[model samples]
Target: MNPKNPYKIALVLLSLFLFGCKDSASIPSEEDLNAREQTPQEESNQRTTGPIDYGYGPGLLPLGDEKISNEPKIGFIYSCDTQLNGGGAFKAGEWINESEGYWDPNKKIMVDGDISWANAQFTLETKGTTREIKGNGLPINHNTGTYPISTQDEAYLYDRNPNSIKEQKVVLSLPVQPTLAATPRCASGMVAIALNGIAIFNGLDAGGKDAVAHEIQDQCDGHPQKDGQYHYHNLSNCLEDTPRDTEHSALVGYALDGFGLYGKKGENGKILTNADLDECHGHTHEIKWEGSLKNMYHYHATEEYPYTIGCFKGNINSENLSQPENNEKPSMGPPPTQP
Candidate 1:
């Protein structure tokens, strides 16, 4: 009756087969893409060998991504936001939940620019032309206990820090390899930056008091100032670092002169003291830096005063280092010209 309709039947079967195979060749699924095409160092644990979050927020940056090219070789990856939780609210909006703000020594709370301005944020960048190590000076972390001077009285050596934590774009053209300065000298403030993006001031409080001794610090060993900029005046455990066992010292941060700063311990399970270091609280050795393979000159934090760095071991970046003491309040410039 239907004669030889076998040819039509065969064509329909072929079409079905092609349709079934079409989905197989379709664009790869997300799972497949993730398996096949993630960054080389994308799968590392931050605590072990990558960028770490100092309780700021969540993001990923591979510290050992060899494909990343640069001039100022970064020892570690940094968050674009400097790991700051931002000026306002704990998570979102403009400080709706003020309860989450850090507690002052008096158990009071401080908010961004509320009593004063907010903290600044830093994002590291490479100046393509000059090979300068560029960073946005951010006031991300600070202890509210002894800060804001709160009183607009010149008697306390301040009315208020005229400067808020505005992003101060700081740059330093460092030597690829650091060398000894002819005569090392101590500066007014900010000899370095901790890995968490906080500035490291010298071990001095207002009125030239020993910061680590007399100044009120938070549980993390830091405090803020009139500018609302949070910083460390001594060796603070707030820096994110792998806990050294009984015998291994860990690198904490870098000095402005291009050397590394280490913790208060040595490799031999010995508590390093100021005696172990030079005038700058540093010594030359075969340090196991994240990127360096050879021995180099680096500073170490002692249990005593000037816990981090004492002075400049290498040529200091004059543009980056300032006479913070001279201004003691760099923010205190002339008042606005009122109409």
Candidate 2:
């Protein structure tokens, strides 16, 4: 109250300074604010170390009476005019974000309290002319989005995935040198196994719709089925290391017919479009095969519909293909409603 009272003024100023400091402490720092904005799945993805185990017990189910031959006849050849609900095909400009209202790469639900596989395993062995691929069906190299979309996650509003990822007994006896079949066959069921030890399914969803365009997937572009088998409907960019501008995309997986599946880039580092590939979503060209550059038939992933394989270009052993048990059948009646 007294302007000339220096001691009182000093006391008041010190109190104000201490109050300001307390208020500032209550206000979060920039780094703390940034961390608060990130979701649990986002935080899990930042990990650079090996897979994390969040105490989800180790229990794997057996592949039951599901047979590849039992799957309904829903296979088809790829075409540019392939009609997809929500949108015809994925273009480079379109991306998964909050505004899209369908899919978001940044937003992911958790699966069994895990964002990545905790017990990943895979191995490829060659003996004489046959190559044996074995694994517990889990992604060995990268991470996955959560499953059974948590009610709190924004992604849950779009896709309420009710399945949790689980390990499976997977064994495939493929050929070291696969030969083209006399006639291309429609691919169905578990069509391929990625290098990371995950399954690669065909493009169709349970309703015969374009799975890539309709269904919501994790940041790694994967989701689990009812059987808890985590698989990919399209190419996940995390599958391979970034290819140099001069390098061709690396082999990411192997189709049921023993043909190699490559990434987006083709010859001369060109991002391939539908026009660049055949009806089977593949082309014959010289590529590094078994340590030597040789001309071979192989499939390629694109941004469009039928993103991976369109049809089987090589001989496939149905016995070697492990089908999903109690696989959801495509609706024979009217088209089901979309989310």
Candidate 3:
């Protein structure tokens, strides 16, 4: 080979060796980004340490030693729409599937200008029958319920109006008249209200009998009752109202622990929203909630979640507390109306 050609080849080989030996920088790792994307637990801890002390709030002062109903029953008032299943079969959609639709803090389900009915079906379901116990005269029949009351008849008691809702109505019919005396009251000012926790634990159900109740937090322990039911505070104001807006957020009643209680049931559902994102940690974990796990009879508002005492009421928590003979009657109202 010629000397010049050999010299060029040797130079090219030297260049290639240099490039291969030199070190290259690596890309930034996920750990670095995670430091910026804070998790909900971290956020919760931060909120806890902040100025807002969520521990202390207005709670229903328990009156006296009461007992829960021996034969507790439950009822459900829901809206339905004709929908299609995967196999071309038509089915009725229940309100529980309308999670975002009903979780609205501003609206109320009213009927007959007295109480707003979230939907016409809610009026028919709850107007007559006790969700917890059956055969109380109020006709809560699923196949053929008779609730003629309508939004034309009732109105939302509380909306933007501050003073609209006062002591509201709650109809509960238990088997033994004596067992019906218990009414739910808030303990330590904290009602069974929750937003993030429920969003995370939504669709979780009890696996079997005596299984530990699944929830985001153990705040249920703070509740006045030993049953460990979680409920929201009731006020005369909207469920979204804070103590600053209203003097006291009355305790509503406990949120039931069941798959059907909240969340849209589906297979391979996408976790898109913030609530869905938080729930990813529990992926593939089945709903522990079964129909027979426990019998919880409670109530809330129809239009929106009841925030005030007069807007919604329940006899569940009170089942363990003693109510005066005169107050034993179900707290019924003229029907909810919107101002």
Candidate 4:
């Protein structure tokens, strides 16, 4: 063979090798790229950093682990002040009928707003042995906080209550003279009806947490549930007859057991505390009963946890009871949004 011919052969071999390399170096396909395992850093980079979902509505998330007690909380006791979600306290202030347009998580005080209902009604009467309480469940005495908290309002960030304050057909016939049961029974759902015609739920919210502390309320300390039934978790300061210093608190409402629920004062006009009462948040004493003072077992409202009835001191008339929309069990999730 000629020398130049040999050189040409070598060049051809080199060219073939280069061409094979070029073919093997082709770019990977989209599927192959996606199939590869991602590194830790890359995986993190691909994830979105946003607010966590705690199975709660806007602003309804507790600041810490929720303080939920198992059912049969009849004798279970806890402090209301400590159950707060670190959100803030609802303080007494001028009514905020309009939205404020911003939410502040660090806000230490929660302001009140007005929720108007045109046909507010309530009545209390005693006929024979039955004390008939009737009303369209609306706060007839004072204005309530706006419901379905408007996105325009700052409270929306904390509580997006989607229900409106609709009137409920409430007619509860309780015994005029309730007698104590052999054993106190656990109470839930609509435990009582405020004198103003609003439903008074037990101290627990739907999630079994301290309702008054975790949930936001109107200036009147009232909010509506899923059924549009206006209700309270604690005694509303807006009640018709709240007695002052040295006077026994007036009869603000009655428990499902048909026992009168008095204000936060005991005899001799002393503001009561959990220490002052029994596990049911009351004590047997001579209170103004049906127009005359008589000694009986009655519940009392306090500025503490389990603010109202802790347990039923008397036999409850389940048939006459107006159950909450979610009456069977405490709701595990947040309330649904308004339609």
Measured against the true structure, the TM-scores of the candidates, in listed sequence, are 0.52, 0.65, 0.17, 0.66
lDDT of 1 by residue, 162-194 (tens): 324334445555554666778665444577776
Per-residue CA lDDT of model 4 for 91-155, tens digit only, reads 21122111332222222223345445556765666689997777788765455666656666555
Model 2 lDDT per residue over 63-90, tens place = 1111122212212333222232222112
lDDT of 3 by residue, 60-87 (tens): 1111011111222121111011110111
Error of 1 at 126 (Å): 6.1
Model 4: worst 10 consecutive residues (lDDT sum) = 1-10
- What is candidate 2's local distance difference test score? 0.56
lDDT of 1 at 33: 19
Each model's lDDT comes to: 0.42, 0.56, 0.18, 0.55
Q: Model 3: how far is 269 from its true place, Å?
A: 39
Sort by lDDT, top down from the best: 2, 4, 1, 3
RMSD of 2: 19.6
Model 4 residue 67 lDDT? 34
* Candidate 3 total steric clashes: 71
Considering only N, C-alpha and C atoms within 3 Å, which residue pairs clash in candidate 1?
89-95, 113-116, 113-117, 120-138, 120-139, 143-223, 162-331, 163-331
Alpha carbon deviation, residue 57, candidate 1 (Å): 40
